[model samples]
Target chain A: MQPLPKELLIEASGGDIGAFEKIYRATSDYVYTIALKVTGNRADAEEVAQDVFLKVFRKLGKFRFESSFTTWLYRITVNNAINASRKSTRRRSGQVEFNDNIEVADGRDRTREAIEKEQNEARVRSMLETLNPDQRACIVLREIEGMRYEEIAEVLQVNLNTVRSRLRRARETLCSRAQQERSIQ
Target chain B: MKCTEARELLASDFLDGELDKDARGEVVKHLDACDGCRRFEEAVRRAAVDPLRNAPRETAPPSLWLKVRLGIEHEQERGVRAALYRVWRSFHVPWTAYAAASATAAVIIAIAVLREPLTVPGSTRASLTDTEGLHEYIEEQFSILAYQDTNGTGNGANGNGADSVNFGTLLEEYLM
Candidate 1:
């Protein structure tokens, strides 16, 4: 359940620790989950989420109240996630290892639909893992988070056309690789 | 739109499509016949839906969150320290320049004050003085100007010969 005391955000901005704790409690899950998906590492994702929240706290004085606090929060979360993923890639290679003989880790195949769906999901994830962080971010925001192109542009601090291009390229790569994987399987 | 264009539209232009019946029929017709395009559509569906629709959503562990929060706190402290150092550095600059200027001025003023006594142009001392005394006086003035130019301002009473110039020249020589 979401909280209703919108005044808490204002108090938090004014350096009230208790108010900030409330804001944190209200929004931590949304921030952390997005960071985790983008970074694919708990350590990196948590760091990113923490940085995002800290920045939100520190820079809260600059907030205009022109946009919804939620949208501003979303922007902070997405930017940190993207930054975390970039750092992770530099520190450790994030390339997907395509193992043709890989078994399902879950080890459950109850029905044909279930088996196909599992296989498809695994293949998609592995292929997604191969993508550069930006493409992975775009895929996550557009397909997973269901964010619109304009919203994505705002989060990324990019143009609408760049978002569109990245989306097309990500989809094309995922689809092409997925097709090849399925044919091989 | 043509069948080829229709595939691109279906790719995700479908999300934006308030396509009327005619365009919908055209897209359906193309899909029914084009195996390549239909497979492409399925691929799109699979990619868009699989991880988002099927995979379990994972959240960060509590301990991990604590670690990150701690790291950010440390970073904030460091950032504040760095900002303070930068401000200190900015304050540091002018004081150094002032000290250098003070030291230079002091040296120049010492040279001017400690300067050799000039013979009054028409004094009984000059009448009594010989050629060697006048030559020594000129050499002494040379040494004083060199010292003041290197060290401080050489403004003084004996307004002639090598060392005699304005305050501006004294500063310029100091600069040079």
Candidate 2:
């Protein structure tokens, strides 16, 4: 989607819903992706996505043009997403801990080589499940999503160094578990 | 720093190349000497890569984001419409009381402006000081009342008083 114009957004802040709708369409994906990545569940992502829009709608009138509209919206979404993830953490930790009987699916491969690769991948995901949501999210964003450290920091509304540090710590934790699994294997 | 602080740094700082040249050397030396830290490094590398590489690359369910965006705008539209409706509702009034007060005021002012002392039409009006004018009209009427009166002698110079021309007897004699 094309980036929404800041000028159109300024017009929208004066109560132009039609203009704001255009801005919403342009930027909703940007917000939703951050939610999906940060919160790590479709439902939480949806809730966070809805919340971002509602906040944007309510606060649109108050948005003075002191900062870039995109950056402002980015900050709001990041802040909302981070808060949602934190709340989900307490609930999520319970589910993972209490539901250890979560039916582990059979590894999806038959060939000897494919089975090994699938097994390794499965073990990786299992290990990742141990991370707190924020750290898990940082790992995903940095390694798989390939976002720059600065961009991740922006999406999480954290300092770039925080993003790097979290990534490193998360990686170390996962590596520790993987090594233990290797020892057992 | 103790091994503990160094471990914390090794976890994050080593990744960033943030360690001073000497600190970096020490961490490398420690990693060469320590089995625990090298495994930590290896685990961190795997944890960082696996999910990104394998956890499903998801775009949101199509048009869901579109719907949420439209929905917020719709909500905003309704809010403005509600405010406008409230302002419009405020303009309606109970007309009877206001109308009645206005009508009564108009009637009282009209009466005050129109009321005046009565005047006779088509008359050169006599001033209030002309009381003598009414008395003079009565004096002019004195000649009009002068009329012949029959004396009790009844103008009876006719030989006998009885034969005198009494008003009634004279009429009788004429008739005879």
Lowest summed lDDT window (length 10), candidate 2 chain A: A100-109
Q: Report, to 2 decimal places, the DockQ of model 1.
A: 0.19
Error of 2 at B152 (Å): 49
Report the alpha-carbon TM-score of model 1 versus the true structure. Answer: 0.59
Which CAPRI level is candidate 1? incorrect
Off by over 4 Å in 2: A1-30, A65-71, A82-129, A133-169, A176-185, B1-6, B16-36, B53-57, B89-176
Q: What is the DockQ of each candidate?
A: 0.19, 0.20
Question: lDDT of all the models against the reference?
Answer: 0.68, 0.65
**Model 1 off-target regions past 4 Å?**
A1-5, A94-125, B15-29, B32-35, B68-176
lDDT of 1 at B73: 67
Candidate 1, residues A42-133, lDDT tens digits: the string is 56777787788788878887877876687788778877787777766745333322222334443453677767765665555566666777
Docking class of 2: incorrect
lDDT of 1 by residue, B18-76 (tens): 35788777888888888888877777877654556455555546675465457556866
